[model samples]
Target: MTRHPVLEARNLRLQFGGVTAADDASLSIAAGERVAIIGPNGAGKTTFVNICTGYLKPQSGSVRFEGREITGVTPREIVRNGIGRSFQLPQLFLDTTVLDNLLLALAAREGIWNTWTPLKRHPRRDEMLDLLEVIGLTETAHQLPRELPEGMRKLVDIAMALALRPRLIFMNEPTSGVSTREKFAIMDVVIRALQHNATTAVFVEHDMEVVSRYADRVAVWSFGRIGLEGTPAEVLNDPDVRRGVVGS
Candidate 1:
């Protein structure tokens, strides 16, 4: 049985002045699959994500989610349609506690425009706590973002994204700023949480170790296009990828 793709982008083209960010990019992501997008510094991996997530409108292309065309939709609209994403930097309310941050995200997900409203009767406390537990941050739920370490901060951001209960999530460099030793720890918790929720994931990653361990499939971007798509081993060992992406 063939499963339909949860997200699909075809013939995506985007440009920023003279630089071509995405050129004829196309990809399909199946439900519950973990995909890693990898390439060198300016290969357009993040640009493609921005386009799909509605942050950047492509000059030309079509984006479909769950069999519906979503190109040119607003970010909030796309998120409401079951797509969510976490940024490379942890996007959180630094002044508030981790728990409160998740609460706000939940409120926003429900279209509660008054974020300042009292959360005493927010009605989603248990759900937020479950998300904290999934990210292994239940102990620090009461702490503010600044008080938490880098890795935990990242987890909190992810937890907030999960608060929306998105069917598909895009993670931009989830392990970027954390120390090497803590990278796997963060990814372990993240992958486990995704599986627990049965959510599909697409992440832009530079760490080959992380990609080999976590990614079920890999997409290699080069000069604004996906030049290679295959298993981690296949993409990692390819001579072209080795030279262009890995800088070997």
Candidate 2:
């Protein structure tokens, strides 16, 4: 028996004025797969992810999750339907402690806003703490996002997305603003957390090494389309990809 893909996008097309963001774009992601979308800037990688997560609506085509259409759903509807995403830039309440950041995420997941309860006293405090521990951010739990380094801030943003308990998560540029030495370590923590939660990952990445080390497969986005999809070695080593994407 053939299992339906967990997420499917079919011939998605989107445009902004004269710029084409997605042009006949389509892809399918299976459960448990770590898929990487790699390309140069403005190649439609982030645009596709935005469409899937409902942050941007496509001009045409459809996005389906678990065999149900969700192209026209709102972002919150997509989240409730088990899809979540983190942005290229870290999005967090910089004034709040990391723990409170996650506590708020947990509350949002349950649609429990407007509570006067303190974060420390939230019902899911322990669960948020465990999530922090899983992502190697336990020690920074009490630190504000402004106090932590960029890498830690990225992880906190991702953890907040995870708190929503998504079946599939899209991470846009998961390793964009970090020291070279810390990129691998950051990805190690993020990937392990995704695995622990049994979530499928689809990340947009510019770093070929990150894609090589972490992705089960890769899709090369070029000029608003995926020109190739293969294993890391296969995609990264292709002559066209090396010339077009890697610019080598």
For model 1, the superposed segments whose C-alpha errors exceed 4 Å read 113-117
Per candidate, the number of residue pairs that clash is: 0, 0
What's the lDDT of the predicted structure labeled candidate 1?
0.92
Error of 1 at 26 (Å): 0.3
**Model 1: C-alpha RMSD to truth?**
1.5
Tell me the tens digit of each residue's lDDT in model 2 across 81-196.
99988989999998889999998899888667656876678877899999999999999999899998888889998999999999999999989999899999999999999999
**lDDT of each model, Cα atoms only?**
0.92, 0.92
List, residue by residue over 44-102, the lDDT tens digit for candidate 1.
99999999999999999899999999998999999999998999989999998999999
TM-score of 1: 0.96
Lowest lDDT sum, 10 consecutive residues, model 1, at 112-121
lDDT of 2 at 73: 85
